[model samples]
Target: NYNVLEQVYDVTKFLEDHPGGDEVLLSATGKDATDDFEDVGHSSTARAMMDEFYVGDIDTATIPANVKYTPPKQPHYNQDKTPEFIIKLLQFLVPLIILAVAVGVRFYTKSPSA
Candidate 1:
């Protein structure tokens, strides 16, 4: 029996069908597996599926003091990275543009030599 969120779940039937494999579920037995569950970032459908295995709730008094439920941190997806070629191109072009602007400024601002 796997304990998660103070609820008991009999995942015996789900062991073979689990995407992570039976070992993962077996390892979660006899303990609060909420952290493992949350860490996997199971989808809403997966969460709904667990309802079928729901057995009962664990008594709060019987739970150990060390056992606490802390939600997993959300993963950061960085979509801001420019393509390598684009970055390299920018690196080459920016300095060239600045040099061109400096040269143009110097040329225009120079005093006419008599």
Candidate 2:
């Protein structure tokens, strides 16, 4: 049984026909395979074909807390980005400052002489 997006699919018959191999599907057993299935970027035809294997929706209450799917952790990057942040802040501020100065100059120039 393969669970994807809260729906269950009985893919036992599809094992042999799977392009990647039966091992791929077998690895996804007893777990949510939404990420695995999406990572392959299956074609529309393949997606449509999945309907034939559809069994029913998963009962969330039946799934053990430990068995719940958890996404892979993302790598942590360097936390200290003061320099990069300053550069980006200046990039935005400089253009805004220039625009404001231009607008001020235009406004002052257009004012009638006293």
Candidate 3:
């Protein structure tokens, strides 16, 4: 119920929308919200909401409904073109090097007069 991570996230998000700036939110993060408890109508609902974020088994809380949840697509290693790219590069360069060497040898070995 007293997990600070969720509260920190909520406070950060709230700061973006608050007209009065984020001083209050920053202060609230460190103290128990007891004095301002009755100022808002849904105090119990708020506490209940915070309680759910206490996922003991997991380090991170489940994504909130306001956030559209998306599981990351698995990396498609099959689509990796690195090997193909390297092969193509070698295919183009290898013959060029061999041809250059052959030409150099032919030029040097030709009759000194011719």
Task: Report the C-alpha lDDT of model 3 over 1-114, residue by residue, as the tens digit.
Answer: 333342323445456655446775567764445465456555565667555434333223353427776999987676346889789888999999999999999999998884
Which residues of candidate 3, in runs, are more than 4 Å off?
A: 1-81
For every candidate, C-alpha RMSD to the true structure in Å: 14.1, 13.2, 12.6
Quality of model 2 by C-alpha lDDT: 0.88
110 Cα displacement, candidate 1 (Å): 99
* Residue-level lDDT tens digits of model 1 in 47-70: 999999999997766667686789
Query: Where is the poorest 10-residue window by lDDT in model 1?
Result: 77-86
| TM-score of every model versus the real structure | 0.50, 0.51, 0.29
Query: Could you tell me the TM-score of candidate 1?
Result: 0.50
Worst 10 residues of 3 by lDDT: 52-61
Top candidate, metric TM-score: 2
lDDT of each: 0.89, 0.88, 0.60
Best by lDDT: 1
Deviation in Å, model 1, residue 102 alpha carbon: 99
User: How do the candidates rank by lDDT, highest first?
Assistant: 1, 2, 3
